[model samples]
Target: MNIRKRYLTLILIVAIALGAVGTYVGLSVFAEDTSLNNSGFANSDPDLIAELADQQENIEENMGKMSKVVDAFSIIQENYVEEVEDTQLIEGAIQGMLGSLEDPYSVYMDQETMKQFNEQIESSFEGIGAEVSMKEGNVTIVAPIKDSPAEEAGLKPNDQILSVDGESVEGLDLYEAVNKIRGEKGSTVVLEVNRPGVEDPLEVEITRDSIPLETVYADTKEKNGKLIGVIELTSFSENTANDFEKELSQLEEQGIEGLVIDVRGNPGGLLPEVEQILKNFIPKDTPYIQIEDPSGKKTRYFSKIEKAKGYPIVTLINEGSASASEILSAALNEALDYEIVGETSFGKGTVQQTVSMGDGSTIKITRFKWLTPDGNSIHEVGVKPTIEQKMPDYYYTNPVQVEEPLTLDQSDSKIENVQIMLEGLGYEPGRTDGYFNEATKSAVEAFQQDQETEVTGKVDEKTAELLQTAIIEKVQEGEDDLQLEKAVETLTK
Candidate 1:
């Protein structure tokens, strides 16, 4: 698409996407603009006027095709056992239309839900601070925001939420599940999560709080006598691009010889933000990303930067890196030949835009599929790293659920997790094969002693909590960040 056409398309989408109040304010301002003609519309944009006209015609034709639907609504209103609200019927019809698309990403949100969504766009909300999506009829976590309650509670990407508190979320939509997950700050919500590779479900209690909107974090690591700048993106929020540029400039001023762009646990946000960040590194010779519309028409977007960075750069990603994160990783790897070091990312290649129904309600529809720089769509298949690296075994271990003290000879998965945690904490448990033998007891006793707890020589509730806490602290210390080390090595070598 040409620049003007693309601008018009974006305007149309935004005009439709804004909430009812926003739309009214926007149109009121537009109508009062001095540039408007006698008809109270901008005559300067003839092309936009034509596009609007065409859209009106399409809407009219589609409305004509919906006569049968109207008839059905009338029949249901008149012949049903009980009277149905017109608002309910109307909302149902809208939902039915979106549901027919059979896409989990396309969903209908009522007025209340739309308000919460707008709050999210404005940044800051009371929730667990995690991105989630519908996958295989389950509400699965995309990734927890950095330092958020979800992350603190150890929620991982692809962790399927089975229940909220004690209620099952089996038939609820993504927004509904999210509503259940969100609450007033300081309120605790128990999530029953089914993590991959874990035989049993885990009950994680998370206290809701105001989720922070800070997206970019910058630091430096010295390897091989070279200072390697590390910029980790937690998400691509509204100010992420500006923050990234400032951080990058500071890093460059520090005379860093290498850089590692980490998007390990980033469940993506605003595409334009990632695009702006990519412009700093991706040369002008290639397109940074491509958007393919439903009609199979693709629009390639390129950065204006004429040259790549002088220093070597590497991208760090993992299963939690998704959407815009995948875009950045794929573009850097495919366009600039940068090494991607980590596990495959969370595949989310579609682009969604919300459209208001003009009544505070909204429908978020998947309008396009985003392709990588090489015209490859990583939809269900995530962006694979050039150098695949998995974290330590304890990083993937599940939380130990202690019903009773896990004594010697216990062969539960919880015991196995404890063993892994014990091993990761440097107290070798002899084996991680789920069997709690004599050596495992010794390992438990050692850990309890180190923790200055009662040395029971058996895994108990207090012992399990201590073990999980130690593992979290170790992971947070970044000492065992194998993927980051590999990334630094790649950049330095």
Candidate 2:
């Protein structure tokens, strides 16, 4: 009788607290009596019974809406023709929930994916060793790790992994594709690669191995009687800061005049690692990156440094450079006198935090949007270089220039093709005729000038190929990259 009174007193206290805020209070009535259902709550304390009834009504309301889903699940389990596992159903439901957000970065990872995720952060994993992302709904290779099987197999930037080991990856998620690609050491995985400008898919067979993450590749070169330090950072991983510091020490000891920090195909990693690296270049207590939460609460991360390196810096970025790379590049460009060369960065300014469920599963969710030190948001609108430079074809193996130049008044089938292409590109090449006239020469000269080529009236092989490649790909074309040359010139000056 004393125990019952104490339980009723505790229930009354909880009910009073909940009623103060007009919230329903729940009470387990039949926890001690297995035979008594929730319907038997009428026999309990009156005021406590009222609070319990309110909670029961709320539960029924929620469950009423879920009845359709329960019914469908039951029907699938019992009446469906093929057998379906409960695990698959639960995982599919979770995947659907995340997919409803329409975010490529937000995803649910299973046990295998969770394992690989941890392995990547630890800086060692058995796989082809490439960073991939879901771009335009396809598993696209951002870049291959240096000295890894993927790099050794000649996997270039922007290669699409279409299939793995004869299994199609048409609708596979990024993590799912990664699982398919990763295998035990010494095993081989055949990947069907779709490379730009290639007619058919190329079959690339790569032998997987334990790939150690070595993010920074450093070297020095003598140009214009000054030693220039060239540091190629692949990603900002766990040991990147230490590796970079060692390389920087080596270069500084040699008295390098300038530094060229290349992050051309870097897909980015660990924000804190990047912050640690940035502190070496930027001053102490300077605002490096700002992050905004969902409620618009902003937090600024500052550099923790004693002294700054006083060398002229140049950061090289391309379409593959993303996330941490963007932050570092933007900070250097905004806070220092460094020049950002190459194409615009791969803008992924939103930050994601992974939460583990303690059951070998995890969910990666977007939690914040990061801003540059200048308070500029670089999410979809990537960081544009001060000097705009386009990357040339990385896989151009043929001879660049043709044997003979196509001149004015020359009647050839190729002339007609060029005229058609020029007209299509809004160059006003007069007509798609076999004869190249003065109008054709003027159009060719205009095209060459726009392409940053010599303004020659005749269509040389370089000019012709550039025009054709640009027309087909709708991008810049050049055998010699003027951007790197410009960077070397800037360093010398």
**lDDT of each structure?**
0.85, 0.75
Instruction: Report how far residue 170 has shifted in candidate 1, in Å.
Output: 1.7
Write the residue-wise lDDT of candidate 2 on 1-493 in tens digits.
4454344334433443433222111223322332333554434446756756675456535555545545555667778899999767757766887888878889999887888888887768999999888877888887777677887666766789999999999987889899999999999999998877555577777999998887888987677888888888988888898899899999999999998888877888888788888888887666788999989999887767765677788888887788998988899988885899988887889898765544567778888999998889988778788777764333332112335888887887667667767775668777777598989999989998888989988878778667645653432232354566666667887
Pairs that clash in candidate 2: none
In model 2, which regions exceed 4 Å deviation? 1-75, 197-199, 306-308, 390-485
Model 2 Cα RMSD, 1 decimal: 13.7
What's model 2's lDDT at 292?
Answer: 95
Evaluate residue 203 in candidate 1 and report its C-alpha lDDT on the 0 to 100 scale: 91
Best by lDDT: 1
Q: What is the C-alpha RMSD of each candidate to the true structure, in Å?
A: 6.2, 13.7
Residue 96 accuracy (lDDT) in model 2: 81
